[model samples]
Target chain A: MNVAPNNQIPNSQGLVKGMHEQEVEIAPGTLFDAEEMVINMGPQHPSTHGVLRVILKLDGETVRDLDCDIGYLHRGVEKIAEHDTYAMITPYWDRLDYVAAVSNDLCYVGGVEKLLGVEVPRRAEYLRVILTELQRIASHLLWLGTHAIDIGAVTVLLYAFREREEILKIFEDFIGARLTAHAFRIGGLWWDAYPEFDKRVRDFLKILPGRIDEYETLLNANRIWLSRTVGIGILPADEAINLSLTGPVLRGSGVNYDLRKAQPYSAYPEFDFEIPLGENGDTYDRYLVRMAEIRQSIRIIEQALDGLPEGPVMAKVPKVIKPPVGEVYFSIEAPKGEIGVYLVSDGTTKPYRMRIRPPAFINLQSLRRLSIGHLVADVVALIGTIDIVLGEVDR
Target chain B: MSDEEKVTPPDPSGDQPQQSETSGEKSPQSAKTEASADKPAPPRAAPSDKPSPPKAAPAKKPSITSEIAGDPFIDKIKETFGLAITEAVQTLGQQILRVNRDRYLELCGFLHDNETARFDMCTDLTASHWPERSGQEFEVVLLLYSTPNNRRIRIKAPLADGEACPSVSGIWAGANWMERETFDMFGIKFDGHPDLRRILLPEDWPGHPLRKEYPIEYRDNEWTDKHIEYREVDYDTSLIDVKYGERK
Candidate 1:
């Protein structure tokens, strides 16, 4: 047994800070000698988006085999949830996938609501739909920017961020927090939607539809963009479904299993929108799905705002939420994929156990399968297309 | 946007039968034809009017509202795995089965096969520790979803400390990472998992942190000193000097 080695510092092997540089013999790959190189890509690298470490075994430019070494960002979130009150647990879920914190809030709160059997206020349901859809669009905007940039389109990053900033501002106006917005309460919203929340959302809906067209124009015909992404990282539909993939990755592979449509939650059934799926489960198809989702999210926001209900957003439930002994699993169609909160409460104010089914963690498991035949450079694109938040993956 | 442009959630009136399988329902070459000029490809096509396969479970409109106890899906599970399931109940509008660890993999396969309950996606695999139940402290929880029927079921099995549970990663590939994470947190071993190493924690980290026995705050700094790299400079003396003006 290679028992727990006492020394903490992972052997600072080949350590020259700025970059991994090995001036070793570049064995000219003749028929005789084809040496494989095992290189570590991140736990520090910028393109990884966070501290994700993937150990790749490469034969020249082609990746021979790869092992993803995750967990650098693990903060014992589930352990922490066990100790905190049910109300406090919702806020921390915001940190799981910071980009779509509203979706996280809704999933956590939805479980609690189901366990309590509390009927949410009709107005709150609409508010939840609007805020979640807005957050979905916001999250996909970030994905579009990063995924585009990963494929070497730097200009799209600037354009995508320009719109995402407005969505964050709307969040800041509503909850006093932007990225990690803890805007949900157990029974309903902690506070009513800011009066101007409607206006700002409407404003975004007006301009974003046109802006989405702008993005399509920029990348739809660009030869470099199409060639780099079109056929890269082809994940077969069976392989994708077998991997328990969800959200865009699964949809891009032509599976129409969006939870919002398959299992309606909140006020989603009332609104009208479509689930955009792709023909091929490649990087470009995933990209197309997310882009269409932004449009669909906008459509949902518009419908929700148009048919805005007028009532209190908070449900009449006890302040100190101690539901009867029971467990409930509430899942929703989050921007990335299906996010669920499995809550087990033992008639206590604090949750006995809360399991977060992070889509990124489940979706990320398919990376090794997707990256098998692709080149080393395409790995970045594959990572981007999956749109994983390390915080969620490690949590 | 035209009238066709507006895509609503599937009608709850039972107009279109649900798709049966969880995934890989589409062939590899399957991609919807590109949108035509006359009518753009609606983001979500109307639910295929194709009828679903024969199901013993009635089409109880898949809504959070109208939650019926003794769902047919639960009945099918109880009927199939009677002895294995120690406890079966309907709680919080969803069905739950608490089974023994020995027959877990068997149950998973039965669920995956189409003849019985064909659960397509294993949404999650996690565990919770109950220190009060000293003998059976760890409880592994699996959340499974049936996409075609819009049904969710939870399977929980109890395991004593250091006892191994059969791995379901074979039946559901999504179970691979999930089982590893559960093993990492609760310290319950999986019988035949491919890579059962600690996933979220360093392999050398002491004790499972999610267990109730593990201290939230480690005052001893024993585990920290052993695992965290701070060899070059001792912060203890430097912090003391900075805090109280030169610790003479």
Candidate 2:
């Protein structure tokens, strides 16, 4: 095993080395030395999903060390949370996980609801389930698109985004805004579902399964797609558990844990759906799990629409939310994973402390472990398989 | 082992007496008699004739508080570890325990591995700044969860000016970035963290931006040299006199 020499080689002439010299004389009093190749992956790389920079210390193609640099998109959301009142902060939640705004809203509003002890109406709960499942589909669509693009598959991106656009159009119909839809309020929804909301949802339900079939037709059995994804970035169940990986990443590793099923919330128990599990625990498994999840989410949405009860959306919460002096931590099965909101209330409208348990942030930790010993090119595939949104990661 | 090495009778004031009284002691010989008794007997004295049965070893009892109390895993952890838990707040299967900074990691370690209070998942790490709070001005909160147990716990450690808490990154690899973010935002140091850097702020940025006292803006006149100095110019613009410029 011919390893390269640890130190710079001395030139035959032994002169103090210039820029191009084979060796350079050590500066006096230098006590320690090591050789490492530093590589900066991105503040703008495509696979990073946002302005995330990973500085890697590499031994040839293997990553020996990784330092993740974030905050490029830090809009000071926490500080903003402090400044804004409970009602006003909903918009900030929308931007945190822009792909799945409803889940973000649920995590935050759920905590606030617990703090205020307000019971949302059954209709509102069903509405929340419908919107959140729709948002989950939308989010997973974006993930499938970007993750495919991160790998060499381009057609999936186009097909996934096409379906995602339909979900956004539905969002636009429900709320005036689409991308950053602050549709949820503390007690319930910002407004009632539009008169055509049910019809539009049913319309999507009818169309989406075919669209999902379209996606599967394009990618699932394609030899190239299977070759790229199957058996790549395989995370063992124990390692996944130890790494604290969540969402589909954990499920792909054969963990039968979904917060919606394990600990039901917001009428999730009322709906009938299967908790999808994977066997191989690889990138292909993750893709299959998410694809199945999208289908399941559609089933949930259809159920929510058929059984959509009639009543007020907002519960009769306090005009001003002044929860008692206490703390409450609420978590929801967001599109990515477990999104948690830890709220400490001192009987004030503003929380004493608000902490967000971002799934992307935790999910990203397994990257280095999965990436090591693999080709540098595989880094993108591994990160894609993890399916992180840097907005949530940095937040 | 000599007779002196043989175990002696436990003192009446020892913890075994209290344990026996609470658990209702039953030796194999006494088990049948106790089972038939109408009412459970109080703590029974060791027989006077027989060598005092080696202080009945404390029963290997499962954690009853955790099973019965329905406390969050972390609360059960604090109780089991004997860590002083102060100002507990509980709601919706979530618990927050305020603990001194000194014992934060100890409590975290127990919670991460303990059978009953298995907070195997460290979900989030964050800090809150309170400049006006008297004894402790900075509060670091660790949010944890157990998928198996279906519970959440918040462990809060308060620090003064220079105190540091042991890092939980060893227990949960996910805490690496989170602990860095906490350090970046609140400047609360985790003493044994492998690499602690300002995660969400530039390395050269002045002061912790999230600190209450850190000025949000800089005023002019006493600017640092780095701010004052512009790029060195070859020639004064006013003195130049030529089609292109005066040669240096």
Candidate 3:
């Protein structure tokens, strides 16, 4: 059998396309010194988090150039939003980031409310904070589990999912769904807390800190975990911001910008919490940052619950939602990063154009920058660290 | 629509003008003039003629509120790029500037590097199609934020149907995928984009799915016929209809 030339490698579809067609250049010494091979990592690989196909150009074991081919989970969400009414679109937002459905719902709901200028009641505002903070913790826990599992620590997945199940049970009790809980309305929450909602939340919160500590005790000092994670995929602060990275990914690079603080939305201003920053922007520092964020989320949720006000849950919003002829860009700090909704309403029942600034989509762009010099195995670590959801990225 | 019962106080009383249909035309405020300039041709702003279908009771509630106001930041932008900025308004406390399409890249570079408004982050880049606006139909919106200044400004550039807007991916690297997605959805071109191709849809996809002319439901397309192999499984829809009928 004849071997293909260096430039004309087969792609994911088995089509013989030139690697140069993908706009990646072969490094100077890589062409003459060693034989170069192009390989596809995913679209079916479990460690990719979803159907993310990364075409990596390899020189021996090192990655020379990489390009991501996404959109496998593309559902044309923005196109669909143009046809649906304002109230009907909230469910679709839940499907964007299935793990952090509550936060996605809050971002979309807040954007619509901002366009309409409807002020949510104090009780609803407080409840929104509590639910979103709980969602942030839940999302971080899932990331912790899956990221660890991807890097060869199978025990963490079981431990992390155990705690995640408790949070999902709370979600099921509150909103009647485990995964995609559309727990918010345009103006406020659909239903107020159940009778034992407070007790259930408090019980979960009580056990959360201890559970987090147990995960730390397992992985913090483990030699194998440290060998695989620490000092891997280090992204500096300036590059992270230039790439428009957000959430914990930006925080891990020591950038002190959190939407909850930089531009406070919802009832976050009423509650007190700290924005955690990492000194080194590596896989381990990102891990520490997310763990610290989980604790801070607990603090915010506890404060919101203690100061939960007494009033009507829903605001005085019109039944047929029609925002004025204007455009509003509303964003909230979601679990993976900053999820924004750019809404344009032409004074109609349906949106003229609805664009989602998905954080994972932007953060995933930095994978090329982070994984270029590392081994092929580190590409998995980098993807896990970025924490992308293909549904949101491709939407 | 309770403007009086706002959680955040309604935009300092003196900065905003009294509510009226002709407020944008009547007021001499630079912001109002900019708002009025935006109201002329675009179908999005010309919502007055075909009034929205009447609502039940809140029809009397004011639909148009004058939130446009001049700000010091906007003044600095206006001073730097005089005619490049065609219109400027602050709606719902969002500072929006409509720039001339030819000078868009220059304006973006200025915004990214200027001291007053260092919009280092390009939050998003997407286009809205208005087929009714014949000459200039596509509106490209760029949402930018300053990490150092903790402020955001939105820049909108109007482009013709097949016109190419200058890409800002060189200034902000994250715009590479966003521009590709825009190209994939609306079929808008971004000049000087390093890799200007489809991001979401397949390379062989049929049409720009987000264009105004495209239908929402799925139809037979060339890409599907080529890629997806069909195994004809007779999943009965009549059974589903019968179950739903029984439940009803």
Top candidate on TM-score is: 3
Top DockQ prediction, candidate number? 3
Give per-residue lDDT, candidate 3, residue B245: 14
lDDT of 2 by residue, A137-164 (tens): 9999999999888878888898888888
Of the two candidates 1 and 2, the one with more favorable DockQ, higher being better, is: 1
Candidate 2: stretches off by over 4 Å: A1-36, B1-80, B87-89, B215-248
What is candidate 3's lDDT per residue for A1-395, written digit by digit as tens?
11111211233343226544565556686543566667888889999998999998888889987778899899989988887899999999999998899999999999999999899999999988888888888899899999999989999999999999998999999999999999899999899999899999999999999999999998999998898889998888878888888989999999998999999999888878899999989999999999999999999999988888899899999899989888889999999999999998888888888999899998998888888889999999899999999989987
- What is residue A157's positional error in candidate 3, in angstroms? 0.8
Compute the lDDT of residue A226 as modeled in candidate 2: 87
The parts of candidate 3 lying over 4 Å away from their true place are A1-33, B1-70, B229-248
**Cα lDDT for residue A129, candidate 1:** 89
For model 2, name the residue pairs that clash.
none
Query: Which CAPRI tier for candidate 2?
Result: incorrect
lDDT of 3 at A336: 92
Question: Please, what are the lDDT tens digits per residue for candidate 1 over residues A1-395?
Answer: 11111111122232232125644555576632576666789989767889988777677788766667788888888877777777777778899998999998899889888888799998889888888988998899999998888888989999999999998998898888999998888778878887788888888788998999999999999999998899998877666766789999999999889988898999888988898999988889999999999888888888888888898888898877877776778888888899988877777787777788889998988888777678999899889999999989998
Candidate 3, residue A306: Cα displacement in angstroms equals: 1.2
Give the DockQ (C-alpha) for candidate 3: 0.30
